[model samples]
Target chain A: MASALINVPAKAKRGDIIEIKTLMSHIMESGYRHKASGEAVPRDIITSFTCHFNGAEIFRADLFPAIAANPFFSFFTTATESGKFEFEWIGDKGFSETASASISVE
Target chain B: MRFLGAIATALLVVGAVGAAEIPLAERRSGYSFMKPDTKTMQDDDTANPGMLWVLNGETLWNRKTSAADKACADCHGNARASMKGVAARYPAFDKATGRPIDLEQRINSCRTNHQQATPLPFESRELLSLTAFVARQSQGAPIETGADPQLAPFVAKGRELYMQRQGQLNLGCANCHDDNWDKRLAGAAITQGHPTGYPLYRLEWQSLGSLQRRLRACITGIRAQAHDYGAPELVELELYLMSRARGMAMEAPAVRP
Candidate 1:
């Protein structure tokens, strides 16, 4: 039920290093904490996240239990041509989400 | 644990000054101590994790339940307009009950009486979501609780609870919030125990939680038995905190460390 938010410039210069920022709403429970009832909270975290530009891989990260909830990432990618930038996040319990933004290179 | 002595010593001085003459400048919202990044999260609607709960709440508000056969929107209309400044006055006196009730109880009563639906379970995700959603409407409004004559007795009770020491550690809320605020303990700053921002997203919890949830942690920290989520004691304390925090900007669904 978590929606992903991504920020990418609508237009960028060819060969420019464009900044991309993304944030996702997730608990990313590490399974180490105990509830009031003394039961351990189960682990549930985004295991992998990847970004592709024009159908080519650009950036990827393997998330771990140490990552904070509502994971946020900031990175730069070389703008090549006008196309869609696709992002995907895969996590425990078969959780997966994808979002895309269109980029136009000047 | 090592800082208990520092907290206690500070409280002794504040307690000796009596209640009336304390300068208003001492009152600071918990926001002041937040890391810059955390403050940014609270300020940015797009980045705050609490927005997730608020969005979920918006959906639930329009969805009809089996018992009511009507959605909240069916009667209340757009919450953005109807709920504006509503949260600021909460923990208000409920004339029907002849007692003060917090926002959570008010929401439950609406479910029971109007919607004919069972009250959402205390601290449940649905309850937190709805509460946050309603509270979001009051963002930037100033807190206006505790001024009613009928609410005076309850507020007094809450004040008494705030100052009374309890548990094995013999700690009262004032020990840290009123006296040692802005001071560090275990590398975390002590905030002034304000209730302006509730149903807040706490980084430590890694999720949105109600004020009662945070209060329980304080009680447990001092080795005291915690009250249940909807206990009257908690409600009274919430009322007192709100009154003490009057005029502070409401930041419901705030992000915290």
Candidate 2:
């Protein structure tokens, strides 16, 4: 099973540009690699990541084979109002993990 | 030039002159040699991947096993209080084996004797998780090994191995780490070999690893035969390293490139 760590501030001023950081555990193995026996090691990587604020998409990123293992994502989003931030990551082999954090804009 | 000659002749000089030891004030942790960004990654829990293993370990510590039907927490209770500074004191002398054992061996011993569970394989994710979890509890605690009189012989043996030259390259660990540290090697800085961190996140491996793994890699890099995991030689080496790095703060789960 995979694990993830996410950091989102709990509070921010209205219209503040907030930073969100997410790190997910995945081998992100590039298919180009091979085993000691000359056989190819299967490629596995997180293909996409998206963030939603109050059900509206705030951020999205498409990943590729070259991404490092345990890919980390950091981006900015303007804090418009008090709401929840939802995160989702999807990848090969039907892999998916989601987490949510709430924010209060004062 | 004389220093370079001495390193080239390290094999002959190993049993003669005592290994040139680094001064305490001059010592620097591997963390000190890392880039600003790499250090930033390590300082932020949200960014460091080793934290993932630490998270898994916390779960494993609480979950009940199949055979013993007991979790580690059942016996040790809250790890925060019970495990603090524990990792700093290994590789500890085990009278039962009449040798020193590292933290990984001690973890497996607990599983075999008390938890009735099969030992996790070396370098396995599960084992790394548990060891990282235990060691994380000792973050910032200074290493306190080598005080025990019983471990004198093993520590001596370890020092021998560290200073002896072998493999096709014919290099001892001291040649680069002790003799030429702060110098660049193939674009990477040579760090003084301090066992301050283990089960750390290495960018090269893209995974968490133990000191033994790093040692084996170093040995193989010089074209020498590597010791098997959990070998007494490795444990003894770990002992001597901990002793040599005495009072250095623990930084397991550190991120390094």
Candidate 3:
């Protein structure tokens, strides 16, 4: 039911600002709700996300349990002699997924 | 009485046009009822959560799940190439059962018969994924169900069910969808019920679900005992809906509020 979809511009002029969009499918349960049996649902969410540009950290987000499921994030960064943009998300239960996309900058 | 004469003629024209079915010129896709942002979300695969299932479906199609050691791709080939415009004619006649079966059932039938795999339970993630993927291939094709002669009786049965009042509220689908569509209901626009999209993404559910799922919700909303998933009655209703919306573009994996 949940999958990751990340988008990045394939090409951009040097020094141009490019938009990057990331979506992660997660329950993001806030742990505040009680079931019919009065048992608390455990909190599950991506606690942090970061993007590195050619090995340098460029964007970071700190998520909370209150975040909605399938959280989508969009941001912009200047396109410099692009090599690769790597993304990492860490969450509850040691959940981690990483993806890499490369862009050509002329 | 010139004004009275003109009003009588207009009412006569409407009555002659078959009041039960919306006129062709007024038939509109649910897309017209959506907010601009929701439409944008559906148009952009990157933002549409339903696409996630479609991507996984591609994986499942090639994974080869059964003891038969056959993948959907093995026989059907690339879904993009073989499945085009296929979903437009679902709730189709099945010779073996002599009953109509929706696309979901068709997929299961293929699995058990051709792939030697147990039928995926209705409402399972895999089923939703595969259906969305297949239906996506028919995105712009017109719905063409009820074309088979064998399906005519079922469509007739479906039409009866569609109009019959039921449940605690004694409200039938026709009461709202056919009679009062385009009007506001509980702050939401009541669209003329169209099933051109199936296995769609409903933000209320925050996931991709089948047409049957939506139907069950409506049934329950009327305080009715929601039919079991894969029930013939549900498929019948689906048939009736598809036939009603014939020639309309399909929009599977559609985003809905």
What are the lDDT figures for the candidates, one per model? Answer: 0.87, 0.89, 0.86
**Candidate 2, A98: how far from true, in Å?**
0.8
Model 3 misplaced stretches (Cα beyond 4 Å)? B1-19
Tens digits of lDDT, candidate 2, B1-257: 57645544553354244346899999999999999999999989899889999999999999898598999999999999999999999999998888999999998999998999999899999899999999999999999998899999999999888888888767778777777776766568889989887889999999999999999999897779999999888888889989999999999889989
Per-candidate TM equals 0.89, 0.94, 0.92
Q: In terms of DockQ, which candidate is strongest?
A: 2
> Candidate 1 at residue A70, lDDT?
83
Among the numbered candidates, top TM-score falls to 2
Clashes of each: 0, 0, 0
lDDT by residue (tens digit), candidate 3, B149-194: 9999999999888887677666678777876686666568889989
After superposing candidate 1 on the true structure, give the runs of residues whose Cα lies further than 4 Å from its correct spot: A8-18, A32-42, A78-83, A103-106, B1-22
- Candidate 1 has which clashing residue pairs, if any? none
* lDDT ranking, best first: 2, 1, 3
In the predicted model 2, the residue pairs found to clash are: none
Considering summed lDDT, which 10 consecutive residues are worst modelled in model 2 chain A? A1-10
Better of 1 and 3 by TM-score: 3
CAPRI tier for the interface of model 3: medium
